[model samples]
Target: MARVTVEDCVLKVPNRFDLVLLAAQRAREISSGGALTVDRDNDKNPVVSLREIAEETVGVEILRESVVQSLQKHVEVDEPEEDDFDNLSLDVVGELSAMVVADTDEDLLTIQDEPDSGPIETEE
Candidate 1:
């Protein structure tokens, strides 16, 4: 089409703000060498984008997804696998438990000491 208007594009994209955002995003994509669904007609990228929207040549859902993706700074990542403590042998578990118990016992002994007891002075 020779002329593209908001009224024409609004039929395809109901929300004016969303229409603007999607059109701008599409324009950027066009400038970045994305294939145009409609003829360029020697017009600039922004005009071509509005024309595409007006013509319904490009899917609105696809344009919406592109806009959302372009605005995203962080992408979801899969959580790391849980540690396989179940694979540990009984002997290893027993040893680790014993070490933990011993450390706890040592901590208890230290804490039981009278708080008022002054630091022991010793000659070098």
Candidate 2:
């Protein structure tokens, strides 16, 4: 209780690297005004965090999630479902292509009748 050792905390967190990461994250939380799960006993943030881990006062899963969230720069979002607009656009393109084919026949006839004239310009 008076002194916190890595051996005590290792029982709760098996990996030394993971234990360091979680302890560091918890210490940061303490500095940022997060509530402590164990008695501080006038100890600093890191010591308090280690004590909490040793005593199993806080949930390891919750701490692990928090650490992962804090470290992540980008948050993934679910893509929107296919909508009516996509289908509508495809239908519009089909209609436009049909119209173009019909117009081409008339255009060929106009060009043959007026061979001397320049190309016909149609306004949309």
Candidate 3:
């Protein structure tokens, strides 16, 4: 079992900070049962990750992207998918936007006369 060090990885990843981040992220992936690019050589997860980075078996950019995705609080986009919106006709989109804009503070504050909920009151 050979030792893995930051110097070994620095050739592939120049920045010390970035190398640390990528190595740590890769270690987490390995611990989580992610596929390995190189032989483990009975090394620990962090060492195996460093070896992969040093040997260029695993791309640093991919590791960087993985780190970013793992750190994000919200993985999914809030906006609707483009394909769904594209399928709608222009007229339908216009009507939807119009409906969305039609709701005002006054409309939202007003209570409707429900059959059983309670007394309907108005601010006047």
What residue runs in model 3 are displaced by over 4 Å at the alpha carbon? Answer: 76-124
Query: Model 2, 1-124: lDDT tens per residue?
Result: 4699999999899999999999999999999999988878899999999999999998889899999999999999776557667888999999999999999999999888875567788999
* lDDT leader: 2
How much lDDT does each candidate structure score? 0.87, 0.91, 0.85
TM-scores vs. true structure, each candidate: 0.64, 0.65, 0.60
Predict model 3's lDDT versus the native.
0.85
Candidate 1, 24-107: lDDT as tens digits: 999999999999998888899999999988888888899889888988999998854453454556668899999999999999
Residue 63, candidate 2: C-alpha displacement in angstroms: 0.7
Between candidates 1 and 2, name the one with more favorable TM-score.
Answer: 2
**Superposition-based RMSD of candidate 1 using all C-alpha atoms, in angstroms:** 9.5
For candidate 2, which ten residues in a row score worst on lDDT? 77-86
